[model samples]
Target: MLEGHPWFQLEVLAASGKSAGNKYRDAANWILEEEMPEEVGNKQVEQIDSKIFENAGIKLIFSALPADVARSVEPELASSGLFVFSNASAFRMAEDVPLLIADINGDHLALVEQQQKSRPGYIVTNPNCSVIGLASGLKPLADNFGLKSVFVTTYQALSGAGYPGVPSMDIMGNIVPYIHDEEEKVEEECDKILGKFTGEAIEPLQLNVIASCARVGVRNGHLESVLVELETDATIDDIKNAFTEYKGNKDEALPTAPEQLIIVTEDESRPQPVFDSYNGSPERARGMAVTVGRLKLRGSKLRFFLLVHNTIRGASGCSIMNAELAKIRGYI
Candidate 1:
């Protein structure tokens, strides 16, 4: 995704792979199943260090580190003037750090300024995979009707657990009901993402979010069933129109931004990883749009099924788009 960006260039490929001293091609096999494109595979894999990034003239970074690793590495890099667009859970709930979905909450980017007052650069974060799916589905509902309560059950993809994840012996044909700390993240992060950013910090939207997360054998997309009770009366057409009409808060077009932020489908069996996972338009925007289907609205109660590409929309793509928004907003 980074290689195809019109504005950003792939500078260095940094990782903790054993092939640290070798080209990215040496570690590509261990990471992705697809053939590594020559675009970035030829870059040397280097150990992640603030000084090394500075020496390489690197100013922007896309971090997909483990939370434990990011907790230590991210601040050091940001302190040294590197914009860290992180996918890790570390610092996501910090008062100053924006748990951002740039299209949903461009206002939250204001927190980056507060962060920069203390340091040369700052970190921006995207929520856990399931939270991304659930939050995307709830944004229009909460905005138009005001959510009184949200209940979600997520059938999350195996890839959300990170590479080499979910041992085959346990997850080959079985669904793991428990994913460590996933439920809590989904329940907590949504309010913050849809929160009101007050220039200094985010005032989390006062709504009760209850979520149950289960890790399924699916490869990529996260499929969630959501039930929301709205604060006002609304018909089915009203709800559907609100969802279809949402253009999001992103003011301008972004290279990685999808043509439609949310695509509402009529097919009952849609949103499956095989068909709807890559629902976003244009080659560059693939997997970046959330696909919602099975909408059933009865008075103030609404139920729907939603899908988001866990790795793309939920992780890397989110951080990439946040950087693009930051660049347009002059925060980068």
Candidate 2:
């Protein structure tokens, strides 16, 4: 997405280290060292600090640090009055910090006025990857039919595990049935992402999410099998409409926003990872659309298959867009 924004001049900021190690080295090499062939640009190779913030005169900070490291660094950055847009799980559930998905809950930015007590810097963290896909598919349905319960089985991508992730042998042809803390993160983050802040606190939806996660071999997209139960009595048409024309982030003019919120496929065998994973919304909507297939509505239950680009839409891309939205809204 950095490449997509040509109108603005962006400089390379030092990529901080996570508990695991350097996550930005490879990319910085390409963007800073290699991309600029002749001119030797200034590159800082130090840890994140208030010195860098003060020297750089940075107005905003976008952090994709490891969860634990973020637990420590994020509050510090925020204390310095730097607007923080994070993709870490650190402060996602904080009543004051926004658990943002630009398409679903952009209005929640109003609560930042009250977040001063948490830290000098207000933080906006995106929801978990699995939850992002679930929430995108649920938002329109909830607005239309009042979603009550969602049961999902996620075939999460290897990239979601991060750098030097699960060994190739462990996931080559095998599907590990359980991923520690994944189900809980999905369930909780989905509720918060779809929630609204009520002056005093963020009030998450009273929706139930039951998830079963497995480590899959797919390099990018995280595919899920979801079954949603609505509170109201509705027909299959209601469900189809939710996925057919749902366009949540379109009006925002977000550079990375998808044109359609949920993509409904009639091709029975559609939304396959190899083909459909890259479609639905590949650019601004990149990782922004939830591709829904096998729509089956029987009585109160609605079943479908969904896909998401775990890292792009679910991780870095989502964080980047959240920052962009904040910038456009004058928060940074």
Candidate 3:
């Protein structure tokens, strides 16, 4: 998306030691040769090393490295005066780091100034892939009716496991009921993302959040079943309208901003990953929208299911949107 954007330019492509193999290198070469033939022009993946920070012209770094690797280098990259928008779990919950969801809480970017006081550059992160969808779905409800507690059970995609992912034999016809620290990340990150940014500090929401995560057989899109208790009574129509009416910085004209952040579906069979996985509007925003279905309201409680493209709105596209938000907010 950044490559296609008018304001942004594609810079260097760096790879970790594990991803510097012939296969990965060849793939990067192929993409440059085929898709970005004119612009990239014979570029090859450079090994990410100490000298990687030598590029003074590079102002931003987008990273999807493993947590430990990211933690090891992010500070150095930031200290080198390069803003980092990362997808790794490292530094996500740091009080000085902003866990950003562009439309939902762009105000969180305010924390960047505080971070810059300590380092020349700063880091911003998107939530866990699964958490992005759940948080996006919850934001509207929390804004309209206020949330008391949230319970989510996620059916995450295989690709979320990264390259090589889950062994086909283990996941071909099975559902693994555990996914590392996914549940805990979701539970904690949601509160911070949905919380208030009081200029000086982030006050996490006091709502209760419980999560159960599993790896499913699907190739893309994380699907979740959520049950939420509201702080106040509201009608079913009111709940539906909150979703339909919700728009997160859509009018800002950000390159990757989805026309509708949340798409509330009325069909009982809708929001399936196969069809709704790419949900969004205005072409550029495809795969950036969260689709919600099977909404059920009982008194002040609500039940629903949502889908988010695990790698797009949940991962890389999420980081791209954060960069755009930062640029618009003058942090980049």
User: Candidate 1 lDDT, tens digit per residue, 212-233?
Assistant: 8888888889999999999999
User: Poorest 10 consecutive residues of model 1 by lDDT?
Assistant: 26-35
User: Which ranges of candidate 1 are over 4 A from the true structure?
Assistant: 30-34
Higher-lDDT candidate of 2 and 3: 3
Residue 60, model 2, lDDT: 73
Clashing pairs in 2: 78-121, 256-284, 257-284, 258-285
Across 1-332, the per-residue lDDT of candidate 3 in tens digits comes to 56577666766777766445334335452421236544554455667753654653778788888899899888888887889999999999999899999989888989989988988889999999999999999999999999989999999999899868899999998999999999899999999999899998799997669999999999889999999999888988888899989988765778888888888898999889899999987677889999999989888889999999999899988999899888887888
lDDT of 2 by residue, 1-332 (tens): 45536322344355555311333333343421226432223443446776677686676777878789899988888888878889889888887888888877887776677777666668889889988888888887888888878999998888788767898888888988888889999988888777877875678887878899999887778889999888788888877886777766565677777777677878988777776665646455555666888888888888888888777678777777787777778776
lDDT of 2 at 139: 84
**Candidate order (TM-score):** 1, 3, 2
TM-score of each prediction: 0.97, 0.88, 0.94
What TM-score does candidate 1 reach? Answer: 0.97
Candidate 3 — which residues are off by over 4 angstroms?
Answer: 18-41, 49-56
